[model samples]
Target: MLEGIRVLACGARDAVRLCATLLERAGAAVERTASDSADYDVILVSSDFDDANVVARWKTSGSHMVCDITATGPQDSRAGRRWSDAQIQAMSGLMDTTGFAHGAPVRIGVPLTEISAALYAAAAIAAAVRVKRMRGIVQNIDVTLSGCAASALTTFLPAAFARRAVGRLGNRHPACAPWNAYRTRDGWILICTGTEEQWRKLKQEARVPQLDDARFASLAERVRHVDELDALVESWTTTLTTDDCTRICESIGVAAGPIVGVRDLADEPNFRMRHAQAARAMKAHGVDADTYRDVSIFETSALSDALPVAKRAVPCERGANAAPLAGVKVIEIGQYTTAPLVGKHLAALGAQVVKIEPPGGEAARAWSPGQGGTSYFFALNNTDKETIALDLKQESARAYLRTLLKDADVLVENLRPGALAKLGFTREALGAINPRLVYCSISGFGMTSAYPSRPAFDTVIQAMGGLMDLTRADGAPVKIGASGADILGGQAALFAILARLAAREENAGAFIEISMQDVAAWCALFAAGNNSARGQALACLDGHIWMEREVSDAERAQCSALPKAVAAVKLAGATPVMRVDELLQDGDFLADVLSAARDANGAFWPVLKAPYRLTKTPACVRAAPGAPQAVRLAPPAPARAPVPEDRPA
Candidate 1:
């Protein structure tokens, strides 16, 4: 396959290396460039490197077909009047996983799919060159990471399009109930018995003859009795080492494997065999055989030996070819968390973000302190941005905001639904003020009427979205420890804004609306069908305790009705919330509870309710040196002051 084609590979460390490796394998002359130089027949650029200026500069000479390998879509500036089929195909594939999942879709994991796209792009360029030699049109391609990730998830799309929900199950597969990791004597082992035959084999291997009983025979029956079956399996597993269990399961022809700990797979004979075969393939090419072997130390031979070598691409240097968004100015008109966070991300990426806070400052300013008076909220989300106090209600402030809008490229806000319009800052008004501006309106629900006016805190949204419902296997709803909804929504808003910016052809100012509720619903539905298929109770306190809250008297009274051993207790008036920290400190209590719950036929103990208490205290109020201070409630003046004032008059 040795050809007369030339390939120019420009990508971040790993992506660049993969492009070069693939092209070299195809027997094409590969030219590595720190900068885009030489009139090659094919040019490959990294997607992670967002230096649009460099891309623009390279496009000028445009002798060869161009393909981007980055996770992001190409800039609007890169678009041209004419493009080839090869270029269009490459661009279509590149836009894969570059957007937000719930937020702006990001290239998760090792960007393995991006590598695939880069290879595809490289192939397209080579084809384009062959066409150009006979015919005469230079092709330009736009590749995006979002599109790549989306394509990778295409198999799941059938379910997604069917409105089936998907989510991170940690290590559990939805279809198989007992197909999960279980604690063993020494370590954990993943037990996957997807087929009925495998399930039968696994039960027999475990020596649990009771599993053969009609009540727990078939896959459906086993799943129905999963709780009891799991207990029996765990009882046997905890007595044997992971190796012992694995060997036993393997002999019985069951799909079972030990969870790999922090151990080198290179030492394993199976891993060594696979590595040797992979090395031979790598050596056939001009690439260093050892490049692929080093990462083999982490591979499990149970999978294929076609593992790609880890790329050692250098991190993007600061001020490297001018920041992608160096001249981009963003006007942030939001408070609390979601909208402000989007601006924070933009600011981090070198955008001039001007935070417009309320006259009394944002409500988050009064949030709990860390080191200084600065709340963790402000520090975490508002970093790398300038804050300015402005009350939109005031004509002076509104006029000032209008002035700011005139020069701004984007406006981000997350007031309650209809609040923005009520303030006369509607999309039409903003578009009229600055037709080129990108306006992002973040709301609890969408701008639409479904739940436009419903109040949506992170906790409330989680509850309403069925997340809380699904989390509690026992039917008790619980909010996620982190404010997942808000953060993910913020990320989604950012991605949406970027997409709008890239495809801003209409120029009437792109109006982007992101709903926190919608994101939560999406997440809920993603995993809902699979979870529902399992048909398990929604509430079961069998997992790790993520948080602890003090139990109320009413809750305590309710728990008192249970057996004494399983009854919930209040620890010094604070509900006995079983937190990991507390469990570690009071091992005796943990052991006691474990014994009690185990003996009581698997009854769960109720812990404290809320993780943290929200209390108000006057003494805690203080003012920062430069920022506004809290207003104090003064004590009543002495009665004598009235008499003194009367005498003075």
Candidate 2:
């Protein structure tokens, strides 16, 4: 999709390498050296790069799309502290929300914050290119690891508002019962039952009559007695091998998968399938990874060219303070986090999004820790949009959806590979309805995947994507504390959509298929080549602090003599590890990252702001789930003649 585009990646070795890998995967011609002195379309620089003269020259050019990837947000850059995934994860609350209830906070295996910042950088660059094409606006983008990490806290931040401490639940979910990893004869298997029907199926599959107890009947009741529920479920699981457990769960239509280790990830059918497709994609561009060591992983630095400022073909439809996506209209058919998150971001940037939910609402509505009949979990992703409930099984609802699509600019969905098609809204059908539509689908696998019907919860993807293995604690695999697969995949989908939007031709539609597994593999590129390190946690007088590099016994002893903050301040090359609760007291973090948003119940809560900063057309959160009066979309235009088949991007 980025064919013929040139990108310069120069900065920290690891960061630049990752940026180059991603740009190359997108078909861009990437140059890894800053000394090339060649004009480029985009330049990505890391904060670690200290060449002041080079930075000054690039900034003055005003012709290239420059993106700076930093450890802190624009407001907090003055602190100038170096960071690693573990420290950022600690400060962002992701680490504190993970691990065993009684144990210390654990780090995510991968460099999550850096990876997230990179994705945002890539998306922002794509957005800038689109703006330049549409209105001749050139913008510099600033992406921060802290900003991205705060964004992922959407699912956990609401609890802080309620004065509830959201501690680590380990493999157990905070919301539902039978939603944890259980031990089997050979290894471990994860079982997740979200609905009542799925819970019944799990019981039947396990032949566990004890699950029929009244205390474990309702969702709330099961959660209240989750410990007993887990004990009962594990009894059945322990009798069988991991494979036996998985087979029975799948056979009964329960969401379950074996907890995969690193050595076994490459052998998984789904991972192998995704790797094969990636190889072919890269090979078409004359780039190929010789082995597993090659598959890899965004960001911005210099502006150089002066494309003539062009007049928009269409009249401006937004106010003077319009956001980046001010006039775009989007239709979102999403459940849970992946596609809904894309919609949330698009809405935050001022797109007019209408979310289509089932008549009974999406499954996420029932997730725990909610307020006034609304799930806080659901509110996090469904913000800044209007919603319509439809029973797609009914022709009338489908007919309404068809009409809604007639004037839509983008359609985002994360349903199973063929679920939408089965309802008669295939890519071809969507293209026929709106030749200008950007149809994007985020799925566990591509539409042509070998395992179309396999269940793909976040747990399953982490296990199969080699994340669990890399995030092991004491040699035992564990999923990342946060929904890494879903968030990363959603961000990737957004990037593809923005790229397609920028390269759009009149009456030309594009189909974007993003596989969660593929995104996981791509993000793991750097981490896959390096040995997994969970980071060192040093004991302090009052609490603990995290450091990515190994700390000797003497260093630990020195730090242990002081409080966490004092230790961080006194110890050379140390910073305080923060928790989600600490965000409430962080002035700088609160200023740029957190915003107050009212939920459907009129209760005010904290939510994350946009993850990137665009100088000209910045992203803003104008409204949330409960707010009314979003950007009023234009009335449906008269249907136009259908165009040729839309091609996939």
Residue lDDT tens for model 1, 245-272? 8678666655455443212222323323
Q: Summing lDDT over every window of 10 consecutive residues in candidate 1, give the lowest-scoring window.
A: 610-619
Which digits, one per residue and each the tens of the lDDT, describe model 2 over residues 138-201? 6677777888998787667767756677667777777778888788999888888878898988
| TM-score, every prediction | 0.38, 0.86
Shift of residue 26 alpha carbon in model 2, Å: 2.6
The list of candidate 1 runs beyond 4 A from truth reads 1-320, 504-506, 529-649
Among all candidates shown, the one with the greatest lDDT: 2
Note the residue pairs that clash in candidate 2: 43-301, 44-300, 63-303, 63-304, 63-305, 64-303, 64-304, 66-301, 67-300, 67-301
Instruction: Write down the lDDT that model 1 would get.
Output: 0.47
